[model samples]
Target: MHIHTPACPCFIIPSSMLRKLAIQADGAERQRLLEQLERSAFLRGQRAASGLAAPGLLVAPGVRHRTVYDAHHGTRLPGKLVRTETAAPVTDTAVNEAFDGAGTTYDFYQQILKRNSIDGRGMGIDSSVHYSKRFNNAFWNGRQMVYGDGDGKLFTGFTHALDVIAHELTHGVTQYTVPGGGLVYDGQSGALNESMSDVFGAVVKQWHAKQTVRKADWLIGAGIMTPAVGKALRSMADPGNAKLTWSGDDQPGTMRGYVEGGDVHTNSGIPNHAFYLAAMKLGGHSWDKAAPIWYQALSLLHPDATFADAAQATVKAAELRHGAGSGEAAAVQGAWHEVGVV
Candidate 1:
């Protein structure tokens, strides 16, 4: 299938969060965060204008290739090539982390989900680390991965967190898997897009750690942010709980708390919580059943699919993968009900 790639890139950090943090911050830090926010807006415009995928030669299935680059605190993407597959690890922590994280994410999809790569066609993974000075965010810019150093105060760095890397990379997977190019980057559809990444991001992390659903932390972007800022970016287990996540997290886990026009990140908590509920109910390694069911549902979605559409797709996927009236299907249905998606 020819997957239509979307022009817009998906960022791990939401602009709303940046704005909130900026308002609270003072001095140079505030200015830097605001600058990053402006850069993010400019990036959207820049990417929309290009309307092109990451330019590179495609490889066949079963061939794993990952390339890492150093942006050297510049705006240019996929900057100078620093490392490649099979190469020795470099001294730069960000470079090594980017390479290793991509490798692990690639392995998780190939070994567990039976996917070739982000595009399921052995498309080479390209990443750039240290993107601009204290840039404060990471993103999959339609074509390649870009990591920001982040202000040391709030974020230690982006590339070092495995879940963070997987989260950004799964954005690429969603772009290729979903029909109609990709999910629309606004409204409920956009929230679902973010949820998909969060779901697979946590699954990839748990799979790598050999952690079962109960044993898993269920926190996205953990260890990426400083403890003073928050435990993580968001919590799948309990969304909108400031104690579990950060002070500024406004994500709602159920329909009652749903915001009419919330940011994609905020609204994603609904689907994220649903996936967590489904996974916990299944009671096993997430990659075994829950992940596969969700992964299969990707092809069942359209660009503008609603929350109800996704709920139905997941229920159908569980039935198709397991059986009619199977436990998997029931769990998925009940999860959607719990989140009021049905």
Candidate 2:
């Protein structure tokens, strides 16, 4: 069945956060925030106009094909081609970061999960850096990655952070992996979409660092935002902890504090925490078991799958992989129960 899925770019920084920061700021900073927010909205419209992907997708066989473009502080996407898969590092930091980050994310999926590229085929990875002047976000536009250099005060730069890059790219992974073109970007399903990105984003970062679950700092988008704004975007280990994240952090670790109509990024903390709990309980490298189980669960999920559905899917994935009464299955179920999902 061909689902006409609207193209909603998954942004690394949520719009709500930008709005909150804008409200707190004044003069030029506030104006900049508002302008960026406007740009974000405009981009969403532009993506919709560009059209969504039709079902029954086809791509090249699984081979790592990466390319980086320089947006040159303009709005146009897949801008000036600067780097290719075989090219050497360029002088521009953003270009190099985009190139390398995409490569690392691709490697993590291919090597760790034994999956191909984003589409489970050899789909080319394209990234554009320096998109718009002092733009404060990075996003996967259902096709490629686009990043903005931060306003220097609020955000440093998008490409510098590995997890931020991985998070955005994984949105593409989720897009092609999930049935019906991708999870609908709202409510519980949207939260699951965001959580999927966060899960693999954390896993990729951990795998890159060779860090165990205990050694890995369960933070996303670390060092992207200015320290004054926050430590990171969210804390999987202790969601909703403002001190660990930022003053504006309001993610709930479990269902008791679930927002009635929360932004996907906000409610994602529930499943994000569940994944963290599962990984910790499994007690090893996150990529070892927790991540694979989650990866497998993607194929078993529908686009509108809820938190409860995801909980069951992961538990089933565990049982399928390790056995009906295995430690993996028990841990997976326990993790969901702890999060009040099942």
Candidate 3:
């Protein structure tokens, strides 16, 4: 129950990953991991500072306001305003990436999903880059986006991958779009939250690339990880890689693989792969068929829904959108069955 507190920072780098990195490192690298752990604690404490705490869906027509700040390697948020929505590009790599990535994500939501912004009310998208020394992470923090430069060992710049940026901001969408101010960020519900971000993250990435389902790499955090980290953060097509290796490239694809407690990041692979299958089987652009079904499922799902609940929701979503016994609905059901969610 403590998982979804308004204060919980929905970190993209799972705590388990930090612990693993800390365990695998030695000497100076070990020291870097320790520093990350310390900084992460402080981030948890300040995550709720966003100031918008209303529950239930609030949709209003606002503007697509975006503000990017530079933490200047410090921990402060909305730090120094380096770029506004109309400002010319600065000479910094992180700033431009943050600004561009946020705009692309906003475009995906507005253009593809037909939602105004994070709140579907044109709520401004705010982001902070270069947070702390070798911070090694990025997150939604319940309000705005916060990014970190990796320790230069296991990962690269968080902004290097537009999917990573879209992934975090989608958390804000997940939090605000649900009843009771979003589902509890724990257990099955929390895993769904993670999967939803991955779902749209993949969608936005594909949409930006103009890639169809067959053409898309179907990997999350693809360019974010350094070549040293064994290739990307997670793979939706094959969960075996994630389950067999500590490097975390894939995840478990069945109900038996569910991480008992609330390991949202690790356990999210099941649903992630389910969506992947649905998209692949449906063929053509993911945003056209799979994304709409999943987006509709997000509204249909109960806040604390289990994997079974999600399977049924998406199946029902497919049936509703594509007809009761249409191929689309069957493919969705088949996708859930492949993941063992059925």
Candidates 2 and 3, the one with greater TM-score: 2
Provide TM-scores for the models. Answer: 0.97, 0.96, 0.91
lDDT of 1 by residue, 281-338 (tens): 9998999999999999999999888899999999999999999999999999999999
Over 4 Å off, model 1: 1-7, 52-55
Given candidate 2, what's the lDDT at residue 225?
87
Span of ten consecutive residues with least summed lDDT in model 3: 54-63
Candidates' lDDT values, in order?
A: 0.89, 0.89, 0.80
Could you give candidate 2's per-residue lDDT for residues 105-200 as a string of tens digits?
A: 989988888777888877788899989999999998878899999998989998988998889888888888887777888899999999999999
Question: How would you encode candidate 3's per-residue C-alpha lDDT over 1-342 as one tens digit per residue?
Answer: 333333457777777778777887899888888888877777667655543444323334434577888998997776998888778899988889988998899888887788888877777778899998888899887777899998777878798788899889888887777655666667888888888898888889999999999988887887676666756677777765853233644357777776687468888999999999999999999999999898888787666777888889889999999899999999999999988888
Candidate 2, RMSD to the unseen true structure:
1.9
Q: What TM-score does model 3 achieve against the real structure?
A: 0.91
Candidate with maximal TM-score: 1
Q: What is the C-alpha RMSD of each candidate to the true structure, in Å?
A: 1.8, 1.9, 3.2
